[model samples]
Target: MSKVVLITGGSSGIGKAIGDYLSSRNYTVYGTSRNPDTIQNSLFPLLKMDVCNLESIESAISELIEATGKIDVLINNAGVGITGPIEETPTEEMKKAFDTNLYGPINVIKTVLPYMRSQKRGHIINITSIAGYMGLPYRGIYSATKSALEITIEAMRMETLQFGIKMTNVAPGDFATNIAAGRYHAPVLENSPYKEAYSSTLKMMNEHVDHGEDPSKMAKVVHQIIENENPKIHYKVGAPMQKFSIVLKRILPDKVYERMLLKHYGLK
Candidate 1:
């Protein structure tokens, strides 16, 4: 029997790439997107779901479960990136970032855990980022959200192990995706003292993304993890740079690592 995989935020980027790859592998794939019109493949069933909306998430999952009877894999890949200095980031904007990036995934997992528990078998992959491990200058808010996700996935992994379910966190370092260009910008604050600093940081981030890895490569790692019977708790995508970053963060002092991150992104 073909595995049934459900991917949130599968409308585009890495999520879309994974959906496309899985379909090619003969998996019965279902993707959820806020904008169904933007989805590339019409052949796979695409449901309109906003991860920030609990009702929409539940309804979509319910419909899928009713139709397919099981979700062998769930990909919590939906997220948003907000760029700005910590001091300049508005309260509302911060809330929105957390809602979609952190809490939204938690809600989806809660709703799906029951079915997964009943089946006593499933895989949950949380799409995190290198930012989760090391904070960036203008991306503090975005990094925090992913950091929360990383911590949550760790705890969830320990709890779910005995249930015969698996949880893997995919932390891909700079992938060439719409994310760099599609950052959610907060309303410009006039008379803000740090505006210049934030602008310089955002510009550096943009330039770094211009030379990042392709999103399709990240998709293949996702496919490999899905097919593995005993997947690792974390899958770091991208080139050796990703592993190097993790190792550097682990061994370097706070100031040294911060400086390296700034220099790596041209913020130095």
Candidate 2:
């Protein structure tokens, strides 16, 4: 039987890579991007969906279900990032990040759950971040958003096990994706209070992004987990730097970890 996969924020970056990878493997792929014109792939059915909008999410899911009759997998990869100190981050900006990164997935999960429950089988893959596990300066909002998603996804994994729903949280440290340059910085430039601070931190983050793993690598991992008979709850896709960071967080003392993060970002 052919599995049907629905991917959110599939217009670009990691989401787009995942969609292409699964589609290549013969899965019926439905991708939703907020901006439809940006989608060059007509082969995979594309719909316009802003994760912040509940109605749009519902409508897109309903349309997909109507056409396919069932969706076997949902990749909640739509998210946004905000770079600034938490105290300096605007209220609306924080809300925007959370809506896109956290609540957005919640809305999609709600819409997809009913259909999956009826079928008694489904897989939900959330594209979270290493920031979900570790905190760094100037990325407070983004970290918090992913942290919220991490906690929610973990709980969902436990709660939905009995219903035959599998939830996997894929945490990518940094990727050579347009997220930092395109998604986060663009928004910050328009409404930035600490323009210099935001720019410096964003520049540093983008430099890391350029040095990070390729999106295709993560796509391959996603394909593996989906095809696997037994899927793990978490998959970390990142460089040695990311792995080291995770280990440091686990082993280092609290103040030591804080100092390391601060020094690396020149916050110290």
| lDDT by candidate, in order shown | 0.86, 0.85
Write one digit per residue (lDDT tens) for candidate 2, span 1-268: 6999999988888888888888888999988988887767456888888888888989999999899999999999988877776766678888888999999998899889999999999999999999888777778778889989999998988888898999999999888888875554333555557566666777888899888778999999999999987898888888888867888899999999999987887765
| TM-scores for candidates 1 onward, in order | 0.93, 0.92
TM-score of 2: 0.92
Residue 220 shift from truth in candidate 1, angstroms: 0.8
Q: Name the Cα RMSD for model 2.
A: 2.6
Which digits, one per residue and each the tens of the lDDT, describe model 1 over residues 137-217? 778899899999999989988999898999999998887778866778654467777666667677777766777888889
Residue 52 Cα positional deviation in candidate 2, in Å, after optimal superposition: 1.3
- The model with the greatest TM-score is 1
